[model samples]
Target: MQKELLKWLKDVGELDSARLISECSVDLLYVDTLFEMSSDRMTDLMDAQIGIPGKYYLKLQLDFQKEIKIIETQLMEVATALGMHIRSISWNPKIDTDKEVQMKISIIVRQAIFDEITLNKISWSGRLEEPDFLNRIFDLSKMPSFDSRFDNAYDDIHKHRIMNYDWEDDWVFTDRRFNLLHCEEEIFLKFLSLTINPVSRTDDEGVGQLIEIYNRNLSESGIEFYEKSKIAGKPIYGYREIAAGNASTSSADAKQRKIALVVGCSQYEFAGLLENPLNDAVAIKQNLESLGFDVMYAENPNLKDLKIKIDDFGTELEKYDVGLFYFAGHGVQVKGLNYLIPVDANLKSERTVEYDCVQVDRILSHMENAKTSVNLIILDACRNNPFERSWGRDLSQRGFAVMDAPKGSLIAYSTSPGKTASDGEGKNGLYTGELIAEIKSVNLTITQLFQKVRKAVMEKSKDTQVPWESTSLTADFYFNRK
Candidate 1:
């Protein structure tokens, strides 16, 4: 879904940042310190009236009705669909931000845009003259926009809103002449969903043919589509990876010194217990050590021990040219910052986040202090613990926030930002399993290694989990280089 649309509201004065979370709720931050307000601005804010979700603003009853309306207007401009709504505007009365601190403005959009739009992912790029998939599945000639004889003003007006106007080209044969052969990944998946949807097309025959065609040609690429579920005897489809990993014995040469800190937290006291992290860590440690890394491994460490190990890892990293750190456990993003939960973490509520868990930024800071030339931070810590949702509707985000890899470093997440990766049924989690196998490849750069792992994870998890990376490394790195 178009989560980026919420940014338009930032144009409204005094808005510091806007975030869209899992529940489709929009949380806005209004920092009093960042920008200057009018001399009587605080007085006006105190006098304002917020009509919808009661008149509570930072321990004071302030009428913010005027400000809320502007935000709602901006929401309408971005969300084109009919279902989106501003269910309520909630501000906790306990917070007293009067002393020039950031004001948290909470807004709930029921049946949020992202929730409404769920698209299955399958990768494909064809070399055909026309989109053969579309030719076989759809009869676009039936659409009103198909005819080139008429120039409708309404259609013209709609076309101009987009950056490139040849979209869904009903008339001339531009790149859009074919059905989604040339389109954004989102649009492509949307079209693919429509093709297999029981309501969209009653004919199961076309869906069958499409799957057969896809698999026959895409087998070498390791992609396959299959029936995920059935609706009233009609089939619903999803795709998965179908290939095996190639084995490699060669490890990185000893020209450059390398060290790795690997931590896996599986054992837990009450909640957030995971199955495969311990196994994942052991496997990674073996792999890194074989590849000439001085591995400092920890499994099921409590909060105190986890911090001590990380600190020590940083201190010892000074002797190495390239350093790597990997964690496999429960992780959450409170507000926008990421926290890696130790096995002993008792995350009861939002307030306990800072005290109970380790901030990923702190780890980055430790790495920065060492001044390591090349650093890699791999986190396979995004298993959606049941307690995370039980705590509160809006509290405890699902996964890690996308972070910029520090200079000379690359940050690889087990799953994409704002999404959780699957805790696997096998010895390791779905992401770490792929990562373990892919790192064995010779001469593949750190960037290439992660991309291959991302593809494998997407295939294995049926697009539910895709790994992500942010890199700023100047030189190439590998497990085994030529």
Candidate 2:
């Protein structure tokens, strides 16, 4: 059975070499496997040995990081036919000082099938015997019966991974396996059943139909497989074209209609001046413009000017599907209400803040009343409150107050509520600098973009500062898409 399986794997180009090693009583199977293409140089050394009377140890070492879930799925089918139950699987990175990193996967299995005559004599000195039925399982003629579309699909996925290698921090080996299983569920299920239960009613016609359905679903999902399959001269199903059309429509909708209002107050009359607000605003304006937004930028705006700009922004929002508002400067919260301080505001007491500063609620009202489909409010204004000492009240808060996002809107704070964010020694603040970098990541969705920004800020601040957000958006939004 082992020999036949090894031969079939070799014939199918799944492995580069296979050998049976006799080190002890039981025969050990060692195979060198390859994935995608030979040029990738990703090799796996699989060692299968019976360590105990009924238990088996399977150790796999890969020369480079790649998906092993497919291998695991195949092995599970093999074990099920042999009446073996997998106990556990573990993964570890084996690092060498002189060489690149290698990933090691170890799996333990225990046998459940018991025939007294066949089981009692299974010892440590000879090869474990397999029943005649088990030995006939690996029929070479049945190998090509499995769907071939999976080969192309997986190749496309691998190529996509290679193309995005530098920016894909989230696409780990685990993610690849997950996408494979979810994206090609029917094909994999049919393959597994055919391999393990050959006597079942699986036919070529049925398998072909399953492959067709799988192909249709993959195309509709807008996954890498669909794009690659098109280049390979394969016919795309109906739903894929529909999905592609919808995507095109969305892109056209966003092209010239997205709007953003950026306000940065650096010079204050009563509050201390900040050096980074103007620079942050300029950088943000450039980034948004690059992403195809009509930006309204303001620097050193007073209370009256801020109100007029925000009101104008509200009027502009009515004609757009996406609206974004960004503010960078002094901010404070009194009595649990957040306010953005202008450059010319003079807050004599807590009572004066209501009339002197811009209320965050009012800004949100502009977005809500404009009826935009998506609204993004970014506040890089959570610096230390400069008027806290002069308030003569218990208004000694560190930063802005926490507020809930209205429906279809997302509000992001420079730092956690009530926590002061850093104005970096560099030209831009910590949060905004990280945000600027992440916004330019073409493939990331808005949520993913913010997650990367949060991670960067935390790491750069050494855990001293953390960004926070409140979101009620029902649909996904991306700054840049490909």
Candidate 3:
């Protein structure tokens, strides 16, 4: 039986030479039981001549399960170290039985990595190779015994469009290779179902009926199918259409209508003014404009004027798919509520801040209420509090307070909550300077962009300042998608 199983594995190219030998070895202690049972009867003597195939088959399945689990654990550790998210890793035992277990693992890579793979046409044949970061995590060579079921589903989905439609409206349909690399859940599952039980012409009545029943059930529970699919796969990062009003526009038009509001308050009437805010704001505005945003630049606005501009910004957000707001100035937190102070504010007491300053929640409310698909708010407002000494009151906090991010929105601070950020000795602040450089990087997702920025800021500040962010975004976002 062991020889037969080894031959079968070799013919299928499932297990490598090293693993096959390790899995086939049986313990000598179990063979003693068979020898002792031979004296019972003639039938028992005949049975002893040939080993039990079922026992050996069950043992092989257990060995495969153990090896696959080890591989999965190693892949997970590598992915976590690289700051990647793995949505699912599973092996199916029903379809191929012990001969070849079907395995599927889905991971969401940064845009840079994804683009490199797509452009270079990298094939993951279960071997560790170049692009060492990805290879380290997804070493397919370790699990050569398991068939990559998801890869076949990805290939089939690429060849056939969903429901025979040409997919002119979907951005993923533009390139077959791109589509295969970043396929959504519903499409992959549809192809997987078809692959498992293909429709054939010479099928018997029972097989045809079973296929019909499967199709009928799939169609009947469409909502449930999509929900289940979402729970299993990695989140997609492609350009999704605006849900509320601009759903009919072309992709090019949607990309062109991106809007940003850039505000920098430096020239203060009552408090000591900072030198780098204006430079930081201008640099940020220029970078954003280069990335195709129609920026509304504001320099040193008063409290009432800032409110007016914010109201106008909220109105403009309705017209765009992506809305970003950036502020570089002084801010304070009073009684656990964060406030962005204007240039003309006169803070006599803690109670006066409520009326003199703009609440951080106001900006978040506008974003949460807007029809935009993605909203980003960056505040480089963590400089040392100018009002702390003048007011002669200990606010119990030095810098900006932490705030939770609304759904579909992200809030990024120049430094961590309650920590002061340094206005750099150069033209721009440390956080904004690093951010401007990272934003120009090719194919960086929002999370990856911040990770790079955080690293640079920490290094430049010599571990004194650490940037922080709060995100509740469900889908992936990229600053530079191409």
Candidate 3 per-residue C-alpha lDDT over 286-351 given as tens digits, one digit per residue, 9 for 90 to 100: 998888898998899999999998989998888888889999999999888999899999997788
Give the RMSD in angstroms, all C-alphas superposed, for model 2.
Answer: 19.6
The TM-scores, one per candidate, come to 0.50, 0.54, 0.52
Give the C-alpha miss distance for residue 472 in model 2, angstroms.
Answer: 0.5
C-alpha lDDT values of all predictions: 0.61, 0.60, 0.60
- Candidate 3 backbone overlaps, count: 2
lDDT of 2 by residue, 132-186 (tens): 2212333323232122543433333334434434423223211322221222333
RMSD of each: 25.3, 19.6, 20.6
Candidate 1: list runs displaced more than 4 Å. 1-253
Q: In terms of lDDT, which candidate is stronger, 1 or 2?
A: 1
Q: lDDT, candidate 2, residue 4?
A: 31
User: Which sections of candidate 2 miss by over 4 Å?
Assistant: 1-250, 392-396
Q: CA shift at 434, candidate 1, in angstroms?
A: 0.5
Where does candidate 3 have its weakest 10-residue lDDT segment? 42-51
**Descending-lDDT candidate ranking:** 1, 2, 3
lDDT of 1 by residue, 231-290 (tens): 897778776554333112122334678999999989887664689999999999999988
Best first by TM-score, ranked: 2, 3, 1
